[model samples]
Target: MKPAAFDYHAPATANEAVALLADLGDEAKIIAGGQSLVPMLALRLAVFDHLVDLRRLDELGGIEARGDSVWIGAGTTHAAVGRSAEIRRDIPLLHRATPLIGHFQIRNRGTLGGAIAHADAAGEYPVAALTLDARMHTLSPRGTRDIAAADYFTGMWSTAMEPDELLTGVTFPVWRGRTGFAIEEFARRAGDFAMAGATVAVRLDADSRIEQVALGLFGLAPTPLRATTTESEVLGRPAADIDPAEVGRSATAALNAVPADIHGSAEFRRRIGAVMVARAWARAVEEASND
Candidate 1:
């Protein structure tokens, strides 16, 4: 199937792209790498009267270190991100999650901003951003603003961004000290979206106590979710004393609105989610202990 007929505008600057979006209103959609949007368009899942392309906006593509955090432009391709040494060293969670996103071909054309803005429940970037407390920066006719990852995702394939707001970049905070990160998921096949997945980040004290820990779950809810209940339950506890299996169960226990589809039933997803959380938690803790 082919996409519906639409007018295309490739803007040379960020300001110009947003201006086009504002002028075109809801009828216009922003196209970056178009890895996700193109498929939706081809299937007629999404239709737009106009598309404001940002491919020519050089300002929206780059990776920079900003003191304690790393800022990645929305237009930066996933392949670029996976190849970035700074990201690999500073934000290992995101670095590790990159390869799990579809395949090399998808990553070659998929932009960071497109993945986060698309806000798919099963997307690796969204779960990694949520786990790392990344901040999303946006530009609009009204001005600029930043949204916390926790508050950014609103529902399945939905976000808090307004119609005219263009996501310019994202800043992921770097975890210092004895920190470790791991991500685990269950997919039916290679390069397929996971049935259930978990990303875990942990920081341990010198004495092997859990100083801070975050568990982000994907493919088990309407939106990517943080296992705050399980996090609070295990925080400050001795690393050796906590049971990863129990933490996994607690992570998925209170989850509501777990999706049920041909992939799997909600209960089955919860079971798979628990196993993922456990595996991720164990690996993260082991890495942190050795750090």
Candidate 2:
């Protein structure tokens, strides 16, 4: 279906994009990759009087390594992140998860910022950002500001972003210690939205004991959920002696707030979430020990 009639503006600069959004106000939507927004537009799930296109904005489409963090442009595509040498070497978890998003075609068209702004519970970017304690840079008519990843998410598809704000970049800190990353999910087919999924990143010391662990879940909550309970349990312990299934069960209990749908029941999600969490955590352990 054709999208509802809307004016389109392709701005060449970030300032121009923000100005357009400020001028259009709530009637405007900023589109980068257009993978998610286009579908919403076509279905009339969203109607805007104007679209502020940011694809041409040079300031929002590159990756850089700064002092201690890896900065990813808001307009950077998933394929770019998946193929980046820096990501593969520094943040391998994100590198592995990027290819699992949608499919090859969608990855080429989906923007990192778009996915974060869309805030789909099942999307990989949100969890990855949160797990890494990433920071997002946002601009609006008011001015530019940085927001911590944990505080940015408000609800399903909702964020701290103002109507006129455009996300410009995301930056995540690097860890020097041994780290492991893992993701597990259940889907009817490759690239389909998951029935349930989990991603975990763990840091370990030379002794093989956990230094830190961040656990996140998708398709089992309104927003991508950080499994604090599970993280608390695994930290300071080596993966070898830890019971993944037990830790997973604790994490699974945190999904009590997840609403049920035709895809699965609350109980089923709890079960699957436990399984995924266990598997992902185990992989994280292996990577920490071997790598």
Candidate 3:
């Protein structure tokens, strides 16, 4: 099947995009990377009367650092972000997670903003955004606003963004000293959507104890979920005292009702998610120790 017939509009500026969206309302869909949307459109899973292309917007295509935070333009490609020296230096977690997103070809065209806007539960960008506590910036004909990652995702394939809103960019606060980061994911094959994945960022004090931790988990829920239960359990604890296997299990123990599908059972996914969280936690500890 092919996508429903739609009028296409290429907007050269952010404001123009916002105006198009406002005028078209819910009938308009923004196309950036077109990685996810194109497939959906091909399958007739999604339909729109208008396609608002943001590729020509030069304003939404760069990486910049402002003080303790880094702002990544919505139009920036995964490949561009992966190769950025500044992003690698300022935000190691994102740099490390980028390679896991599909393959080189997909990365070359996939935009970070597109991924976040899609809000796929198993998406790499959503996991990074959640773990990093990134802030999403949006523009509408009415005004502009910033939505915290915590509040941005409401459910699978759903977000806080309104129909007329345009996601301009995202800002992530840089983690400095004594921080270690790791990403662990399980997929049927390379470049396939992960069955389950976890990203861990840990900070240690001078005593080598865990000072802070953020765990973002995917593929086990409707939305990318932060393992707050696990964080509370492990925070300020000595790394040596925490067992990776046990921590992994306990981290997702509360989610006994995880979704079951053709790829896996609820139990199987929970088990895989647990192990990922454990591995990520262990690797993060090692990273922090060596830092």
Off by over 4 Å in 2: none
Question: For residues 1-291, could you state the per-residue lDDT of candidate 1 as single tens digits?
Answer: 999999999988888888998899999999988989999999999999999988899898999999999999999999999999999999999999999999999999999999999999999999999999999999998999999999999998999999999999999999999999999999999789888999999999989999999999999998999999899999999999999999999999999999999879999999999999999999999999999
lDDT of 1 at 32: 87
Candidate 2: tens digits of C-alpha lDDT, residues 1-291: 889898989998888888888788888888888999998889988999988888788788888989788999999999999989998888777887897899999999899999999998888888889888899999988889999988998888999988888899999887667888898888768998777889989988889999988998888887888888778877888668998998789888856676688777888888998999999988988988887
lDDT, model 1: 0.95
Candidates 1 and 3 compared: the better one by TM-score is 1
Q: Which ten residues in a row have the lowest lDDT in candidate 1?
A: 12-21
Per-residue lDDT tens digits of candidate 3, residues 1-291?
Answer: 889999999988889999998888889899999999999999999999999999999788899999999999999999999999998888888998899899999999999999999999998889899999999999999899999999999998999999999899999999888999999999999988889999999999898888889988988898999989889888988888889898788778887457788999989999999999989988998989998
Error of 3 at 286 (Å): 0.3
Order the candidate numbers by TM-score, best to worst: 1, 3, 2
Error of 1 at 157 (Å): 0.9
Model 3 — TM-score against the truth?
0.98
Candidate models: Cα lDDT each: 0.95, 0.87, 0.91
Better of 1 and 3 by lDDT: 1
Error of 1 at 144 (Å): 0.7
